[model samples]
Target chain A: MRLEKCWFCSSTVYPGHGIQFVRNDAKIFRFCRSKCHKNFKMKRNPRKVKWTKAFRRLHGKDMTQDSTFEFERKRNRPERYDRNVTMETLKAIKKIDKIRVAREARHHKMRMKGKKGIEQKAAERELEQGISLVKAPLALREESSLTLSKIKVKVSQPQAEYQMEE
Target chain B: MAAFVASKWSKVGPPLLDNLRSSRLLEPFGKFQDIASPGWNGLLFQQLRTFIQMRTKLKVVDNSGAKWVRCIQALKGRKGARLGDTIIASVQEAQPRGKVKKGEVVYGVVVRAAMQRGRCDGSEIRFDDNAVVLVNKQGEPIGTRIFGPVPHELRRKKHLKILTLAEHIA
Candidate 1:
């Protein structure tokens, strides 16, 4: 086999002595070792070095009429889709979403295990300081109020009067 | 692991913040406020240390948040004397060329121009807006006046410009 010229140094490269480097410029270069490749990289001037075959052929300015563009267009095509099947898929998606939400809630609880202590401490401090940490929707406001009343009853003896009357 | 890092930051970081916040040096200069969470004190310390170590190219904004202090060289004595031009001239006249050895106080100022942080917006960043003058012993300005070294490559091209917030300094 005829010897290949080293792309960087232009030296004759034996069969196993070098590897080929192809650049966006469409030039092919062979380097004897990584050291030469590194030195080539260390050169600050961009105009000094030449890149190899694949780089040049792949990167240069877009030539839309190139054969590769036709090949790429043929490889990627829209799938034949049916609208009726999409609605069925959407129904199945809703079921899947319900299950996914349940799983996410479990995962959320697991993640909260470590932070629960911190939250509890904050909650206890808020309670001791007579601060409200209640967060609930308007629909649950009456229920939350009842819950608060029960808590207040348990914490103090004011509810004993009602119980004795009953 | 996140908590550990946060805890370490809290415990180890305050002294540096204290240095930045309590630089009694800044009190007389201008209204330096802390907007940071833990505070500007820690941020200032970290920035100061980074500037001193040459780890960053970013210049420091003085306590007033107006001027940028680049190429900082600090000589210390008293901070009061270097406030006005008279003090700066007197100190320069008293000690001529070379280093003013014993009685010399250090002054630290930014060498390159300072732009108000938000001038592109309406709010201008100023040097003297909130600045403190650090002076040396016997009340002189010799301690610190930022100079773009005469013929040096890195600093020579840069000229010093002070961004005045108000007509405070005469």
Candidate 2:
């Protein structure tokens, strides 16, 4: 079972251990244990409860909402968490990376546009050096971008050469 | 209280310059969700009353005992909107458009998930004493809070470390 962070307290939660309360409205609340659960139950005033029911009644379950709910429920459920989630999350995270990359690319392109060839060459060199020092993973471990099996072959190449010499 | 609870339209106060002639032709309808105050309950109840009144097509929707309706009403028009046609239409017209401006509003992903499950987004902003408020990729806001204060032990840890998954594992 995958460990989950308590939605309420950020405590670690193990499967089969926490209290599961499905809001009378179908929303699931998982607690790490009884303490957080007790507090959660105790904190409920008439106002919060009415707000919850009203909101649920307002937004009837539909596909987009269901998927989002599933993503979260699956996020906590280890069985549904796999490469799919990782890929989706990575794709989403890539939006941030793309923004930075595009900014630099545009800035560099602008700097080179009006420069003379010789000065542009020097500028390009400076830019390359600057980029080299950025320490981005894509720049640092370019070779490791290969598949795991390819990485295994690369790792074993020196041993193979040594064995052939022997 | 007005700064936080008042809608942007309310802050701008009725338009001084009506570029769009539609404003001149159409009678400026009073905003549907206009009574929000700093008090959490008052804002929620008024909005819910509007939602029910609009949903039922009745001009007046009474709030008998449901206090949560206040927050619920503000929640009516998002994604899978649930309130009646009249309220939903008013909410749509009243909703601020495009991306967030002003100070960013931050919220937690779990809370986001909870709200999405219930089909609402703005509710998470109300009582987040513990959630971290940060900026996200959209340059939009993000915030999260555990339901309570940070435990003393967590105060010394790093950002992600402070948020433990131990309680959510099940």
Candidate 3:
């Protein structure tokens, strides 16, 4: 059975699942679920919607260009089936899957490499700007040295606290 | 002047004679009229591939109360009806309080056919079920709302009202 990709989310739509729409122009659009179909009916652009694969790909949030994806493409020309070839292909699928998973993890890590530093910097800036919210400005000046050290501790503390809250 | 006339005749006469011979050959089969008609050549091939024959049960895809309709006749040709073709049908089942009643004969337009139809873009489309939208003699759809996807072929068939009322145009 051939698996189709959802037009909106880019999720796999297996046979006997999802809805297929063939436009008057004969462009086939397969939706993974009613949610995708509804979004399409509303004329929402997949690239503009943040949840869609097109959005993630367009915004560089997901891997758009990758050789691993080439294997999953539809091949109209049929390959001559042989017992040995089929057996080899079955074995290769597992190896390919492992490689693809590792590559995806690496891609995700690369995308998120500087995210922690950027988030920390933004938090620090916000804390500096909103320092008066936590402590009065007049009192901060009197205890500036003590508060600076306390603030540093508080910055690290909040992150741990946030994780605990989650 | 005779030589010029002969040259002119030489250019057109053989083709006209060939056309006459072909028409005469096809006349016994009763398809010559369809072949000779302007703009019918395209539809002639389509008619051969059409699947909705007389008595074919089609799902009514409009809110007009018809649930199922049995085709009584194909409006366009004798063979069968394809996508975007008009057909005369009798409502087999319908909503009791709906606009139309059971056994009511109505004019309808084929919106989606179970048979695969090829498009200009080299793609083929086939729907899960054969469907039709109830229309009046004026070719205006009886239903204000169309429930499912309608093909673009309807637009070419001049069924713009049905297209506008459709939920989706696939």
Candidate 4:
């Protein structure tokens, strides 16, 4: 039997436990428990929930970026750790943590700076709105004047290969 | 001390009535499946890949190519869409003066796909052809008639009326 990670919590999911949802695209999502499945059904983001591992990783709580946690880092110094050297290290760490606190506050503001795109900002824009471009003032929307905003035009790169002048 | 403590209880205000953070409509779709991750399982059919791109022309399978559709957007920014995705499309070819006319932009939900979709239960699902059902601006199917199989996801989205009209549900 193969082991899978729970889609919501990022925990190990053994077979015979947890429910799975296969989207129409055939992408499978396996959840470890009813709580995770219910959270998925209710449209909850695992990255937003404080309890999940996704939240830890997404918000940089992954211990990799938690500079304060460096005090308990796995790396060992090659030389002997003397009392004075250790004390100096501790003092430097204390000062670093103080700086990190201020840096984190600045990062928090920067992370919240950007806005979502206009289309996704509203949930039911398509359902509530009509096609304004199609129903133009003129019949058949005169080809030259038609502003097809949604349709993307194919841009050919002519400059990629150039002919040498004789 | 007892008189002073009793007076403080009256000074406190009652709890607020309305809950401020209960908005659910901000999300475009619930149960979104991420197909852009490192490796997306297996091959998504090539025809289905081009079936719903910008300026893609689709023949109404049930109608035998009589009606044509040109896809605009896949509703999500993923650039391409798969089965059960709703697309904004314009009717390029339809019966003259019919219920749906040429040049009318409408919402079409993909009911079938040539792409093989896999289930969580280790089973694979594939359809023979690509198909769609036109829906109104309200996300409900326009006509009372549906030609072919529809997905259970659509029914779960409260498009039960469309299922009642469809021949089958996959």
> Fraction of true inter-chain Cα contacts (below 8 Å) kept per model?
0.00, 0.00, 0.05, 0.00
Shift of residue B43 alpha carbon in model 1, Å:
22
Q: Estimate each model's TM-score.
A: 0.17, 0.17, 0.48, 0.35
Off by over 4 Å in 1: A1-77, A121-166, B1-34, B37-170
TM-score of chain A of 1: 0.25
Q: Give the Cα error of residue B66 in candidate 3, in Å.
A: 21
Question: Could you list the CA RMSD of all candidates, in the order they appear?
Answer: 28.9, 32.0, 33.1, 31.4
How far does residue B12 in candidate 2 sit from its true spot (Å)?
54
Alpha carbon deviation, residue B83, candidate 4 (Å): 1.0
Q: Kindly list the per-residue Cα lDDT of model 1 for residues A13-58, writing each as its tens digit.
A: 6655544433323244455555444444454222343444333334
Instruction: Provide the lowest-lDDT 10-residue window in model 2 chain A.
Output: A60-69
What TM-scores result for chain A when each predicted structure is judged separately against the true chain A? 0.25, 0.27, 0.80, 0.38
* Residue pairs that clash (backbone atoms under 3 angstroms), model 3: A22-B170, A23-B170, A24-B152, A24-B170
**Residue A7 in model 4: shift from native, Å?**
31
lDDT per residue, candidate 3, B15-87, as tens digits? 2333444444334456455545333343334323358989899999899999999999998866798878899
> Whole-model lDDT for model 4 versus the true structure?
0.59
lDDT of model 3 at residue B90?
99
For model 3, how many clashes?
Answer: 4
